[model samples]
Target: MTSIGGAEMVDWNLAVATATRLVRPGPEVGRDEARAIVAELREHARSAEEHVRGYTRMFGEDADGAAAPHDTPVLVVDRPGWVRANVAGFRAVLTPLLEKMQERRSALPGGAVLGAVGGKVTGVELGMLLSFLATRVLGQYETFAPPSFDLPAGTSAGRLLLVAPNIVHVERELDVDPHDFRLWVCLHEETHRTQFTAVPWLRDHLESEIHAFLAETDVDPSTLLERLHEAGQSMTGGRASGEDGEGSAAESRSLVEVVQTPAQREILGRLTAVMSLLEGHADYVMDGVGPEVVPSVGEIREKFQQRRAKGAGRLDQALRRLLGLDAKLRQYRDGERFVRHVVDRVGMAGFNRVWTSPNTLPTKVEIAKPADWIARVHGDAGN
Candidate 1:
């Protein structure tokens, strides 16, 4: 890690500014209606926390018996606020990668000059990426948010964000009950919050994995230049280096997939396994909540799965693929199946062992083979 002029590799402030400017406005509502929506979302989040804890058996015998030591704060935000929060998260978690990029830049002949211009260019690119995501995400538990007043009582625990407009927009699009939809969304998000807050070491373990991944980046100056050139060509309607005909498999790969080294790919596999487990666990918890809690739970899941399968418009779909979001979609399905299989084979208590420590978590191969994870973690006792 190296610093040139004591400045960051990506201009984060500019990233926020660019994203805010480009992001689409949320569905319109009256001021009072907006306030009501925000308030209800907040209430739903709190209530969902209780339901998630009870169903997942995360806290204790009684949902209230053993509360999470640091209850993460919930923030109901619009698109711009979500962008800002994610940019903060990106800056915090990506520090090592940024420093690595800076080191690469410094080794070049005109390194300082490259850093100055590259920072803003990278900022704009990041901003464009965030703008695309801001509208689509319904809720996110920002695992890497920097410590700030955003956390309750100044605790460094992460914050749960409910994107009010996205929630409203999706419910309307799906023709679902807003109340049930909102609560359903909260249930998924609250499960993530509980996973981190209740388990304690989860967040730090994830952060370490991310840092480890970034620290292994070995992109040289020439490779960086080549990637930038390829990116420029793609942006200007030119085919990428090896892109051949329409619907080529290579064309669907994201920049993330294209640039990884073998070492980075191995680390990414581990990270993917962890993320899959977390996300799958959340989906399992949400779906497992009975109809008494979310009356339209079945309808919501059905419609949402259809919507996810259909995805957005062509250009949006292309962007999603470019951003590696399509892989994220796979994680949900695969991870959920993995969780479902394990829970059926063993039980909730046996499944709980996955959260005991990092070692107990599934490997990438084991994620696809629940039997392997069970054998490794629980042995035949689970049988």
Candidate 2:
């Protein structure tokens, strides 16, 4: 093991070891080979180091009160043990659905589904699947250009921070039939990736809103100061009262809780809407694409929905506590319903055309009023 700045150097071997422990074997490769592949993946990591530094410089802290460029650390965890474990868990839940997708793809009339039919086990394959799905969903939007998925680890995989670009990180946990479930996962991630890629402005928009929210974070410094002052006064008065008790010391301890400002709430509401739209689009695409190919598509879809609903409990709570936002499953449902209504009324072309401009996209109001959106779409078509 090498050391950089007292941190143990994470080479390909260590990366391989970490991955083997985290991921179970899929159809594509075995445990030993997985490690070897991860070893090869280290080369990419070295090249990505410069870019990682660049990202850090932009997103990292700087003196002189000047903001960094990116302000986010792009970590290439050759051994992201926890993330790999989570990926594996997600794979276990998604396996049955993936198998169904493969069977369904085999039965398709033509080669409409090309790349997706194969089981996805490698990083490149995963990237390809995501790219393909993104292209399919947001391909029509002129401004919606898919980002290069094959960039070195530190580089952006679209807008997502690539914690593990190689299979070494999360491959073992992935236990689905490569042909089916991997396709589904690819679709889910790519749905998000494509939205950001196609609508370039959306990435900046979301980040700006989040920054605005954070900037206005109303953590009352004065409250803490006041508490300290009170504690000081109590300590001085304690000599006169002869009440310097044990519980008195505990009472002096104070904590400051950060409350969300109005700006944060407004920004969070918009973010919720965007997230809902993204999830909704993925659900709709999965439904539209899977039924024709996968026999158990509906079952897989239901299972996924149930899994998401269950997972949302923790996610919703965490978001509300940390960011003052709720990850609304209902919002996703409503957004899906809205998109589906548009598709039903005007067809895929019309529904997809909505991405042509930022203005054409639905507002938070339109998410609730699917019928109104439908009427508007129909009315526009009539014009």
Candidate 3:
């Protein structure tokens, strides 16, 4: 890897090899196949590079003649260590749970589709596949311009970050087994990409809500400064605020945290509700698809529930902490129940009709009170 202005460029050949290996776990690409894929990827990379360059020429520099973009540079990686770490972490933590989830499919409304894909994958290869899948899903939305994954330069867009390091850290901590982890993560992230793509309005809705929340957020600089000063003093004196005087600095820090404003809270609530619905629907789809495709569907579903019960990362909690929007646990249950109810009452065809329009889709209230939703659908059908 060569560094330019603190950004490292990744070798595309290595990336393709890693990705190919992950997608087709046991066999290595033959010399001819490797050459062909690398050639194709190079062409793809060239196009991506050109796109990024054009974007830079138009929007890269600010009025001050300095690079104004805040996003990390998009570099091609042939063998990024972080990518491997992420794949490994996801496998370690998520695979066993998925296996367990497969066992309990009967109890779950839609647990039949666990481990739906049965191919072997190396960690690096998995990341490449995920990145590719994410691109496809995000491409469905007209508003979302795909990032230049092949480029070696950053863009002005800060919202969509390819924070490979952060991703690796989170995946590692989650500690799920790799194969199952990759499947779930692929489904999860791909679901997000699909939802944003399928619901064009939702992209703006989420972005606007996030901006609105961020705009209203007020951090107490004074409090932050005081805390820093106190920490410095304690470090020098070896005596903090506690009676023991040997306690850690955290002990002396204020327990109070930043509180959300009413407006922020409202936005957060709406965001969480939508996210929960999205996740729940994905879970439903997975459950539906898994049993038919994967042999271990029942075991995986059981494992997934056990992981959740053991205080494993809740989709809502992680999203809330990351975006300041909490997807309530009940929201998933409600959303899943709603989907199942809709499917049961009207069949998949009727359920699909609701997605014909955002307005037709069930509201937060409808999600909570599914009977009203059923009645509305029936009444509409009668009309």
Number of the top-ranking candidate, with TM-score as the measure: 1
lDDT of 2 by residue, 29-96 (tens): 57686555444333333332333333222123459654333212222232233333333333433333
TM match of model 3 to true structure: 0.45
Error of 2 at 49 (Å): 28
The parts of candidate 2 lying over 4 Å away from their true place are 1-178, 221-258, 292-295, 310-328, 375-383
- Candidate 1, 1-383: lDDT as tens digits: 25576555777888899889988898988999999999999998888887887788767543765655436779999999999889887777777877777776787887877777777777776777788789999999987777777564446578899999999999999999999999999999998988888787888888787788777777664455444444444544556434555564236667667658888899899989988998898898888984868889999999999999998655565566677788898899989999999999988988888989989989999999999999988887867
The per-prediction tally of clashing pairs is: 0, 19, 39
Model 3 ranges with Cα > 4 A deviation: 1-146, 150-185, 218-259, 312-331, 353-358, 376-383
Clashing pairs in 1: none
TM-score list, all predictions: 0.91, 0.47, 0.45
Q: Rate the local accuracy (lDDT) of all candidates.
A: 0.81, 0.42, 0.42
lDDT of 1 at 231: 47
Candidate order (TM-score): 1, 2, 3
Q: Candidate 3 residues 1-383, lDDT tens each? A: 22222221222344345544443221244767545533443343233333332321223445897643222222222333333433433342333333332333324443222112112122233344333322212111112233335222232221222322232333344554423433433333333334443344665665566566655544432333344334333323433454264543233333112425677667666655565566676566656654443345566666656644454233222222222222334565678888787777777666655544445656677777666776776676622
Error of 1 at 215 (Å): 1.0
The deviation in Å at residue 306 for candidate 1 is 0.4
